[model samples]
Target: MATRVLLLMALTLYIFPIATATFHVKGSVYCDTCRAGFETNATFYIRGARVGIQCKERKTMKVAFYSEGVTDSTGTYHIEVENDHRDNICECLLVKSPIKWCSTPDSGRDKSSIVLTHYQNGIVNHLHYANAMGYLRDEPLPECHKLLKYYLADSDV
Candidate 1:
Protein backbone atom coordinates (compact mmCIF):
# COMPACT_ATOMS: atom_id res chain seq x y z
CA MET A 1 0.00 0.00 0.00
CA ALA A 2 2.82 2.45 0.82
CA THR A 3 4.60 1.72 -2.50
CA ARG A 4 1.40 2.27 -4.48
CA VAL A 5 0.76 5.66 -2.80
CA LEU A 6 4.30 6.83 -3.54
CA LEU A 7 4.02 5.77 -7.17
CA LEU A 8 0.71 7.60 -7.56
CA MET A 9 2.16 10.82 -6.09
CA ALA A 10 5.16 10.67 -8.40
CA LEU A 11 2.95 10.08 -11.44
CA THR A 12 0.75 13.05 -10.53
CA LEU A 13 3.72 15.36 -10.24
CA TYR A 14 5.12 14.25 -13.59
CA ILE A 15 1.80 14.66 -15.37
CA PHE A 16 1.15 18.20 -14.11
CA PRO A 17 2.31 20.94 -16.46
CA ILE A 18 4.13 23.99 -15.14
CA ALA A 19 2.79 27.38 -16.20
CA THR A 20 5.23 30.19 -17.00
CA ALA A 21 4.66 33.72 -18.31
CA THR A 22 6.89 35.40 -20.93
CA PHE A 23 8.35 38.88 -20.81
CA HIS A 24 9.90 40.80 -23.78
CA VAL A 25 13.36 42.26 -24.18
CA LYS A 26 13.00 44.92 -26.87
CA GLY A 27 14.69 48.10 -28.12
CA SER A 28 15.42 50.07 -31.32
CA VAL A 29 18.35 50.37 -33.82
CA TYR A 30 19.92 53.67 -34.77
CA CYS A 31 23.02 55.26 -36.32
CA ASP A 32 25.90 56.56 -34.25
CA THR A 33 26.82 59.63 -36.33
CA CYS A 34 23.56 60.81 -37.94
CA ARG A 35 21.30 60.01 -34.97
CA ALA A 36 18.41 60.09 -37.44
CA GLY A 37 15.85 57.28 -37.49
CA PHE A 38 17.65 54.23 -38.88
CA GLU A 39 16.53 53.21 -42.36
CA THR A 40 14.14 56.15 -42.36
CA ASN A 41 14.75 57.88 -45.69
CA ALA A 42 16.66 55.19 -47.53
CA THR A 43 17.51 52.07 -45.67
CA PHE A 44 18.71 53.89 -42.55
CA TYR A 45 21.39 51.52 -41.48
CA ILE A 46 22.55 51.49 -37.87
CA ARG A 47 25.88 49.84 -37.27
CA GLY A 48 26.71 48.93 -33.70
CA ALA A 49 23.82 50.63 -31.91
CA ARG A 50 22.84 49.77 -28.36
CA VAL A 51 19.78 47.72 -27.39
CA GLY A 52 18.20 47.02 -23.99
CA ILE A 53 15.13 45.57 -22.30
CA GLN A 54 13.05 46.75 -19.34
CA CYS A 55 10.58 44.29 -17.77
CA LYS A 56 7.55 45.38 -15.76
CA GLU A 57 4.51 43.68 -14.24
CA ARG A 58 1.07 44.19 -15.68
CA LYS A 59 -1.37 44.19 -12.74
CA THR A 60 0.83 45.44 -9.90
CA MET A 61 3.16 47.52 -12.13
CA LYS A 62 6.57 46.31 -11.04
CA VAL A 63 9.97 46.22 -12.78
CA ALA A 64 11.53 42.77 -12.75
CA PHE A 65 14.55 42.82 -15.08
CA TYR A 66 16.76 45.15 -17.16
CA SER A 67 19.55 44.38 -19.68
CA GLU A 68 21.34 46.02 -22.62
CA GLY A 69 23.32 45.19 -25.82
CA VAL A 70 25.16 46.82 -28.72
CA THR A 71 24.23 46.69 -32.40
CA ASP A 72 26.51 45.92 -35.36
CA SER A 73 27.14 48.31 -38.27
CA THR A 74 23.69 47.36 -39.46
CA GLY A 75 22.35 49.21 -36.41
CA THR A 76 20.70 46.08 -35.03
CA TYR A 77 20.40 45.70 -31.26
CA HIS A 78 19.69 42.53 -29.27
CA ILE A 79 18.63 41.45 -25.78
CA GLU A 80 18.06 38.20 -23.94
CA VAL A 81 14.56 36.78 -23.53
CA GLU A 82 12.60 38.12 -20.57
CA ASN A 83 11.27 35.16 -18.63
CA ASP A 84 7.91 34.90 -16.81
CA HIS A 85 5.15 37.56 -16.57
CA ARG A 86 2.91 38.16 -19.60
CA ASP A 87 1.33 41.46 -18.48
CA ASN A 88 4.61 43.29 -18.84
CA ILE A 89 4.93 45.61 -21.89
CA CYS A 90 8.31 45.99 -23.67
CA GLU A 91 9.54 48.84 -25.89
CA CYS A 92 12.68 49.86 -27.84
CA LEU A 93 13.33 53.55 -28.55
CA LEU A 94 16.07 55.47 -30.32
CA VAL A 95 18.44 56.64 -27.62
CA LYS A 96 20.44 59.30 -29.48
CA SER A 97 19.22 60.59 -32.84
CA PRO A 98 21.73 62.24 -35.10
CA ILE A 99 19.18 64.97 -35.41
CA LYS A 100 17.69 65.69 -32.02
CA TRP A 101 14.53 67.36 -33.39
CA CYS A 102 13.70 64.50 -35.76
CA SER A 103 10.17 63.15 -35.48
CA THR A 104 9.41 59.83 -33.79
CA PRO A 105 6.58 57.45 -34.41
CA ASP A 106 3.73 57.39 -31.91
CA SER A 107 4.36 54.70 -29.33
CA GLY A 108 1.80 51.84 -28.96
CA ARG A 109 0.32 52.83 -32.30
CA ASP A 110 2.71 53.08 -35.24
CA LYS A 111 3.55 49.58 -36.34
CA SER A 112 7.21 49.04 -37.03
CA SER A 113 8.58 45.66 -38.11
CA ILE A 114 10.32 45.73 -34.74
CA VAL A 115 11.07 42.16 -33.65
CA LEU A 116 8.73 40.60 -31.09
CA THR A 117 8.63 37.15 -29.47
CA HIS A 118 5.79 35.69 -27.42
CA TYR A 119 6.81 33.15 -24.76
CA GLN A 120 9.74 32.12 -26.91
CA ASN A 121 13.49 32.80 -27.01
CA GLY A 122 14.33 33.65 -30.65
CA ILE A 123 15.11 36.66 -32.80
CA VAL A 124 12.07 37.81 -34.81
CA ASN A 125 13.62 39.90 -37.57
CA HIS A 126 11.89 42.33 -39.99
CA LEU A 127 8.82 42.86 -37.82
CA HIS A 128 7.65 45.80 -40.05
CA TYR A 129 6.42 49.27 -38.96
CA ALA A 130 2.70 50.14 -39.17
CA ASN A 131 0.94 53.47 -38.67
CA ALA A 132 -1.49 56.03 -40.22
CA MET A 133 0.93 56.55 -43.09
CA GLY A 134 1.99 53.29 -44.69
CA TYR A 135 5.68 54.26 -44.55
CA LEU A 136 8.03 57.19 -44.62
CA ARG A 137 7.82 58.86 -48.00
CA ASP A 138 9.57 61.78 -49.66
CA GLU A 139 6.49 62.91 -51.58
CA PRO A 140 4.82 66.23 -50.78
CA LEU A 141 2.79 66.17 -47.55
CA PRO A 142 -0.35 67.40 -49.35
CA GLU A 143 -0.39 64.25 -51.48
CA CYS A 144 -1.13 62.21 -48.38
CA HIS A 145 -3.56 64.73 -46.91
CA LYS A 146 -6.22 62.05 -46.65
CA LEU A 147 -4.12 60.17 -44.06
CA LEU A 148 -4.02 63.14 -41.66
CA LYS A 149 -6.53 61.61 -39.28
CA TYR A 150 -4.45 58.51 -38.61
CA TYR A 151 -1.08 60.23 -38.32
CA LEU A 152 -2.34 63.29 -36.42
CA ALA A 153 -3.53 61.19 -33.50
CA ASP A 154 -1.44 61.11 -30.31
CA SER A 155 2.08 60.01 -31.32
CA ASP A 156 4.92 58.50 -29.25
CA VAL A 157 7.43 61.14 -30.33
Candidate 2:
Protein backbone atom coordinates (compact mmCIF):
# COMPACT_ATOMS: atom_id res chain seq x y z
CA MET A 1 0.00 0.00 0.00
CA ALA A 2 2.79 2.43 0.88
CA THR A 3 4.58 1.68 -2.41
CA ARG A 4 1.42 2.43 -4.36
CA VAL A 5 0.92 5.71 -2.49
CA LEU A 6 4.50 6.80 -3.28
CA LEU A 7 4.07 5.98 -6.94
CA LEU A 8 0.86 8.00 -7.09
CA MET A 9 2.48 11.01 -5.47
CA ALA A 10 5.37 10.89 -7.89
CA LEU A 11 3.01 10.71 -10.84
CA THR A 12 1.01 13.68 -9.57
CA LEU A 13 4.07 15.84 -9.23
CA TYR A 14 5.34 14.88 -12.66
CA ILE A 15 2.02 15.65 -14.30
CA PHE A 16 1.65 19.07 -12.67
CA PRO A 17 2.35 22.12 -14.84
CA ILE A 18 4.78 24.94 -14.13
CA ALA A 19 3.66 28.55 -14.39
CA THR A 20 5.57 31.66 -15.50
CA ALA A 21 4.94 35.40 -15.85
CA THR A 22 5.22 37.30 -19.12
CA PHE A 23 7.47 40.29 -19.67
CA HIS A 24 7.35 42.98 -22.39
CA VAL A 25 10.03 44.14 -24.85
CA LYS A 26 9.86 47.68 -26.15
CA GLY A 27 12.13 50.27 -27.82
CA SER A 28 12.48 53.02 -30.41
CA VAL A 29 14.14 53.18 -33.89
CA TYR A 30 16.84 55.46 -35.30
CA CYS A 31 19.63 55.70 -37.86
CA ASP A 32 22.55 53.37 -37.08
CA THR A 33 25.43 55.83 -37.43
CA CYS A 34 24.21 59.36 -36.91
CA ARG A 35 22.19 58.08 -33.98
CA ALA A 36 19.75 60.74 -35.06
CA GLY A 37 16.04 60.11 -34.81
CA PHE A 38 14.02 59.02 -37.85
CA GLU A 39 10.96 60.95 -39.00
CA THR A 40 8.57 60.98 -41.92
CA ASN A 41 10.40 63.53 -44.00
CA ALA A 42 9.34 64.64 -47.51
CA THR A 43 10.18 61.16 -48.75
CA PHE A 44 6.98 59.53 -47.69
CA TYR A 45 7.74 56.68 -50.06
CA ILE A 46 10.40 55.37 -47.67
CA ARG A 47 8.95 52.51 -45.69
CA GLY A 48 9.61 52.07 -41.99
CA ALA A 49 12.13 49.46 -40.80
CA ARG A 50 11.41 46.02 -39.43
CA VAL A 51 12.51 44.69 -36.01
CA GLY A 52 13.01 41.01 -35.13
CA ILE A 53 13.15 39.08 -31.85
CA GLN A 54 15.29 35.97 -31.42
CA CYS A 55 15.71 33.42 -28.66
CA LYS A 56 18.75 31.17 -28.27
CA GLU A 57 18.68 27.96 -26.32
CA ARG A 58 20.88 27.92 -23.25
CA LYS A 59 22.61 24.55 -23.61
CA THR A 60 22.84 24.19 -27.38
CA MET A 61 23.31 27.92 -28.08
CA LYS A 62 21.02 27.62 -31.10
CA VAL A 63 18.17 29.90 -32.13
CA ALA A 64 14.92 28.39 -30.93
CA PHE A 65 12.42 31.09 -31.91
CA TYR A 66 12.03 34.25 -34.02
CA SER A 67 9.44 37.08 -34.25
CA GLU A 68 9.26 40.39 -36.11
CA GLY A 69 8.02 44.02 -35.65
CA VAL A 70 7.75 47.26 -37.66
CA THR A 71 8.95 50.76 -36.68
CA ASP A 72 6.83 53.91 -36.86
CA SER A 73 7.74 57.06 -38.80
CA THR A 74 8.88 58.56 -35.50
CA GLY A 75 11.28 55.58 -35.30
CA THR A 76 9.48 53.87 -32.44
CA TYR A 77 8.74 50.15 -31.98
CA HIS A 78 7.35 47.84 -29.33
CA ILE A 79 7.22 44.02 -29.14
CA GLU A 80 5.84 41.44 -26.75
CA VAL A 81 7.33 37.94 -26.42
CA GLU A 82 7.47 35.01 -24.07
CA ASN A 83 10.34 34.85 -21.65
CA ASP A 84 12.78 31.95 -21.72
CA HIS A 85 14.77 30.12 -19.10
CA ARG A 86 17.17 32.14 -16.94
CA ASP A 87 20.04 30.85 -19.04
CA ASN A 88 18.43 31.46 -22.41
CA ILE A 89 19.47 34.48 -24.48
CA CYS A 90 17.17 37.07 -26.06
CA GLU A 91 17.89 39.68 -28.74
CA CYS A 92 16.13 42.25 -30.96
CA LEU A 93 17.41 43.45 -34.33
CA LEU A 94 16.60 45.64 -37.31
CA VAL A 95 16.12 43.84 -40.61
CA LYS A 96 15.44 45.20 -44.13
CA SER A 97 15.17 48.69 -45.74
CA PRO A 98 13.97 50.44 -48.97
CA ILE A 99 16.13 53.50 -49.53
CA LYS A 100 19.03 53.61 -52.05
CA TRP A 101 21.63 56.01 -50.57
CA CYS A 102 20.74 54.68 -47.14
CA SER A 103 21.44 51.27 -48.63
CA THR A 104 25.09 51.86 -49.47
CA PRO A 105 27.64 49.14 -48.71
CA ASP A 106 29.55 50.98 -45.97
CA SER A 107 26.22 52.06 -44.56
CA GLY A 108 25.59 48.38 -43.99
CA ARG A 109 22.39 48.90 -45.95
CA ASP A 110 20.59 45.86 -47.21
CA LYS A 111 16.92 46.00 -46.31
CA SER A 112 16.82 47.44 -42.76
CA SER A 113 17.91 44.66 -40.42
CA ILE A 114 19.15 45.67 -36.94
CA VAL A 115 20.03 43.35 -34.06
CA LEU A 116 19.58 44.40 -30.37
CA THR A 117 20.23 42.28 -27.31
CA HIS A 118 20.42 42.71 -23.51
CA TYR A 119 17.45 45.03 -23.13
CA GLN A 120 13.88 44.30 -22.13
CA ASN A 121 10.74 46.20 -21.04
CA GLY A 122 12.13 49.67 -21.75
CA ILE A 123 12.53 52.33 -24.39
CA VAL A 124 15.19 51.84 -27.12
CA ASN A 125 15.06 54.72 -29.54
CA HIS A 126 16.80 55.69 -32.81
CA LEU A 127 19.75 53.32 -32.50
CA HIS A 128 19.43 52.04 -36.05
CA TYR A 129 19.99 54.14 -39.16
CA ALA A 130 21.55 54.71 -42.61
CA ASN A 131 24.71 56.79 -42.89
CA ALA A 132 25.52 59.47 -45.50
CA MET A 133 27.17 56.80 -47.67
CA GLY A 134 23.80 55.03 -48.04
CA TYR A 135 24.70 51.89 -46.10
CA LEU A 136 22.65 50.88 -43.08
CA ARG A 137 24.16 50.34 -39.63
CA ASP A 138 21.78 48.54 -37.28
CA GLU A 139 23.40 49.31 -33.96
CA PRO A 140 23.08 51.91 -31.25
CA LEU A 141 25.45 54.82 -30.98
CA PRO A 142 28.51 54.37 -28.69
CA GLU A 143 27.42 56.56 -25.81
CA CYS A 144 26.79 55.57 -22.21
CA HIS A 145 23.38 57.21 -22.39
CA LYS A 146 20.58 55.12 -20.90
CA LEU A 147 18.58 54.84 -24.12
CA LEU A 148 21.61 54.36 -26.37
CA LYS A 149 23.23 51.74 -24.14
CA TYR A 150 20.22 49.50 -24.49
CA TYR A 151 21.18 48.94 -28.13
CA LEU A 152 23.76 46.37 -26.96
CA ALA A 153 22.02 45.07 -23.86
CA ASP A 154 21.06 41.39 -24.01
CA SER A 155 19.23 39.26 -21.50
CA ASP A 156 19.78 35.66 -20.37
CA VAL A 157 16.33 34.53 -19.40
Candidate 3:
Protein backbone atom coordinates (compact mmCIF):
# COMPACT_ATOMS: atom_id res chain seq x y z
CA MET A 1 0.00 0.00 0.00
CA ALA A 2 2.83 2.39 0.83
CA THR A 3 4.57 1.61 -2.46
CA ARG A 4 1.42 2.38 -4.46
CA VAL A 5 0.97 5.70 -2.65
CA LEU A 6 4.59 6.65 -3.33
CA LEU A 7 4.23 5.87 -7.03
CA LEU A 8 1.15 8.06 -7.29
CA MET A 9 2.93 10.90 -5.56
CA ALA A 10 5.82 10.65 -7.98
CA LEU A 11 3.51 10.76 -10.95
CA THR A 12 1.67 13.81 -9.62
CA LEU A 13 4.91 15.68 -9.02
CA TYR A 14 5.99 15.08 -12.58
CA ILE A 15 2.70 15.87 -14.28
CA PHE A 16 1.60 18.88 -12.23
CA PRO A 17 4.62 21.02 -13.09
CA ILE A 18 4.44 20.09 -16.76
CA ALA A 19 0.77 21.00 -16.90
CA THR A 20 1.22 24.44 -15.33
CA ALA A 21 4.56 25.35 -16.92
CA THR A 22 3.24 27.92 -19.35
CA PHE A 23 0.13 29.86 -20.23
CA HIS A 24 -1.27 31.63 -23.29
CA VAL A 25 -2.67 35.19 -23.16
CA LYS A 26 -4.84 36.26 -26.07
CA GLY A 27 -6.55 39.56 -27.01
CA SER A 28 -6.95 42.13 -29.78
CA VAL A 29 -6.37 45.81 -30.43
CA TYR A 30 -8.74 48.14 -32.27
CA CYS A 31 -9.00 51.62 -33.80
CA ASP A 32 -11.79 53.91 -32.66
CA THR A 33 -12.38 55.72 -35.95
CA CYS A 34 -15.57 57.20 -34.54
CA ARG A 35 -13.61 58.60 -31.59
CA ALA A 36 -16.13 56.94 -29.29
CA GLY A 37 -15.00 55.61 -25.94
CA PHE A 38 -16.00 52.12 -26.92
CA GLU A 39 -16.33 49.96 -29.99
CA THR A 40 -18.94 50.85 -32.55
CA ASN A 41 -20.10 49.69 -35.97
CA ALA A 42 -17.49 51.86 -37.67
CA THR A 43 -14.66 50.68 -35.42
CA PHE A 44 -12.07 48.42 -37.01
CA TYR A 45 -9.36 46.07 -35.92
CA ILE A 46 -5.82 47.41 -36.19
CA ARG A 47 -3.30 45.29 -38.01
CA GLY A 48 0.38 45.54 -37.06
CA ALA A 49 -0.44 47.23 -33.77
CA ARG A 50 2.01 46.66 -30.95
CA VAL A 51 0.83 45.05 -27.70
CA GLY A 52 2.64 43.97 -24.55
CA ILE A 53 2.19 41.81 -21.45
CA GLN A 54 3.80 43.05 -18.29
CA CYS A 55 3.86 41.43 -14.84
CA LYS A 56 4.94 43.48 -11.86
CA GLU A 57 5.49 42.63 -8.24
CA ARG A 58 2.51 43.73 -6.23
CA LYS A 59 4.40 44.75 -3.11
CA THR A 60 7.46 46.39 -4.62
CA MET A 61 5.88 47.64 -7.86
CA LYS A 62 8.86 46.33 -9.80
CA VAL A 63 8.56 44.72 -13.18
CA ALA A 64 8.89 40.97 -13.06
CA PHE A 65 8.16 39.89 -16.63
CA TYR A 66 7.63 41.73 -19.91
CA SER A 67 7.03 40.74 -23.55
CA GLU A 68 5.65 42.35 -26.70
CA GLY A 69 3.76 41.12 -29.74
CA VAL A 70 2.41 42.55 -32.98
CA THR A 71 -1.13 42.12 -34.16
CA ASP A 72 -1.81 39.81 -37.05
CA SER A 73 -3.88 40.67 -40.09
CA THR A 74 -6.97 40.29 -37.93
CA GLY A 75 -5.61 42.66 -35.27
CA THR A 76 -5.39 39.80 -32.77
CA TYR A 77 -2.35 39.13 -30.62
CA HIS A 78 -1.40 35.91 -28.83
CA ILE A 79 1.38 35.92 -26.27
CA GLU A 80 2.79 32.92 -24.44
CA VAL A 81 3.90 33.66 -20.89
CA GLU A 82 6.19 31.34 -18.97
CA ASN A 83 5.62 30.28 -15.37
CA ASP A 84 2.76 31.11 -13.03
CA HIS A 85 2.52 34.75 -11.98
CA ARG A 86 0.27 34.37 -8.97
CA ASP A 87 2.09 37.00 -6.93
CA ASN A 88 2.35 39.60 -9.65
CA ILE A 89 -0.06 42.03 -11.22
CA CYS A 90 -0.22 41.40 -14.94
CA GLU A 91 -1.67 43.63 -17.63
CA CYS A 92 -2.04 43.79 -21.39
CA LEU A 93 -0.92 47.21 -22.61
CA LEU A 94 -1.28 49.04 -25.91
CA VAL A 95 2.16 49.97 -27.23
CA LYS A 96 1.72 51.47 -30.70
CA SER A 97 -0.74 51.90 -33.51
CA PRO A 98 -0.09 51.28 -37.17
CA ILE A 99 -2.47 54.07 -38.13
CA LYS A 100 -0.94 57.46 -37.49
CA TRP A 101 -4.34 59.17 -37.46
CA CYS A 102 -5.47 56.87 -34.62
CA SER A 103 -2.26 56.71 -32.62
CA THR A 104 -3.40 58.04 -29.26
CA PRO A 105 -4.25 55.48 -26.61
CA ASP A 106 -7.82 55.50 -25.47
CA SER A 107 -8.38 56.68 -21.92
CA GLY A 108 -9.53 53.98 -19.45
CA ARG A 109 -9.09 51.45 -22.27
CA ASP A 110 -5.37 51.36 -22.79
CA LYS A 111 -4.54 48.64 -20.29
CA SER A 112 -6.39 45.54 -19.20
CA SER A 113 -5.74 43.49 -16.10
CA ILE A 114 -5.27 39.74 -16.57
CA VAL A 115 -4.78 36.90 -14.13
CA LEU A 116 -2.03 34.46 -15.17
CA THR A 117 -2.00 31.78 -12.50
CA HIS A 118 -3.53 28.49 -13.48
CA TYR A 119 -4.21 27.27 -9.99
CA GLN A 120 -5.98 30.42 -8.92
CA ASN A 121 -8.26 30.65 -11.94
CA GLY A 122 -9.47 26.99 -11.87
CA ILE A 123 -9.10 26.84 -15.66
CA VAL A 124 -7.92 23.61 -17.19
CA ASN A 125 -6.88 24.96 -20.60
CA HIS A 126 -4.45 27.56 -19.17
CA LEU A 127 -5.69 30.20 -21.55
CA HIS A 128 -6.24 33.74 -20.23
CA TYR A 129 -8.26 36.28 -22.17
CA ALA A 130 -7.75 39.99 -21.61
CA ASN A 131 -10.08 42.86 -22.46
CA ALA A 132 -9.62 44.52 -25.85
CA MET A 133 -7.41 47.59 -25.93
CA GLY A 134 -7.84 50.48 -28.33
CA TYR A 135 -6.44 53.72 -29.76
CA LEU A 136 -8.40 56.92 -30.48
CA ARG A 137 -8.48 58.71 -33.81
CA ASP A 138 -7.13 62.26 -34.04
CA GLU A 139 -10.40 63.26 -35.67
CA PRO A 140 -13.75 61.57 -35.54
CA LEU A 141 -15.10 60.08 -38.72
CA PRO A 142 -17.50 62.21 -40.73
CA GLU A 143 -20.51 60.17 -39.69
CA CYS A 144 -19.56 59.85 -36.01
CA HIS A 145 -22.40 62.04 -34.82
CA LYS A 146 -24.92 59.82 -36.53
CA LEU A 147 -23.29 56.68 -35.17
CA LEU A 148 -23.12 58.08 -31.65
CA LYS A 149 -26.79 58.93 -31.73
CA TYR A 150 -27.61 55.26 -31.73
CA TYR A 151 -25.71 54.81 -28.47
CA LEU A 152 -27.13 57.90 -26.78
CA ALA A 153 -30.68 56.82 -27.49
CA ASP A 154 -30.32 54.02 -24.93
CA SER A 155 -29.02 56.36 -22.20
CA ASP A 156 -30.87 59.01 -20.21
CA VAL A 157 -28.51 61.66 -21.58
Q: What is candidate 2's TM-score against the reference?
A: 0.45
On a 0 to 100 scale, what is the lDDT of residue 113 in model 1?
28
Local distance difference test values of all predictions, in order: 0.40, 0.47, 0.90
Which model is ahead, 1 or 2, in terms of TM-score? 2
lDDT head-to-head 1 vs 3, winner: 3
Alpha-carbon TM-score of each model against the true structure: 0.41, 0.45, 0.87
Question: Against the true structure, whose TM-score is highest?
Answer: 3
lDDT of 2 by residue, 1-157 (tens): 9999999988664454222423355555444343333321211222465667677776898987678776666555566565333455656655655554453233233223223322342323323332221223355345425543453367443
Per-residue lDDT value at 112 in model 2: 39
The deviation in Å at residue 28 for candidate 3 is 0.6
Clashes of 3: 0
Best by lDDT: 3
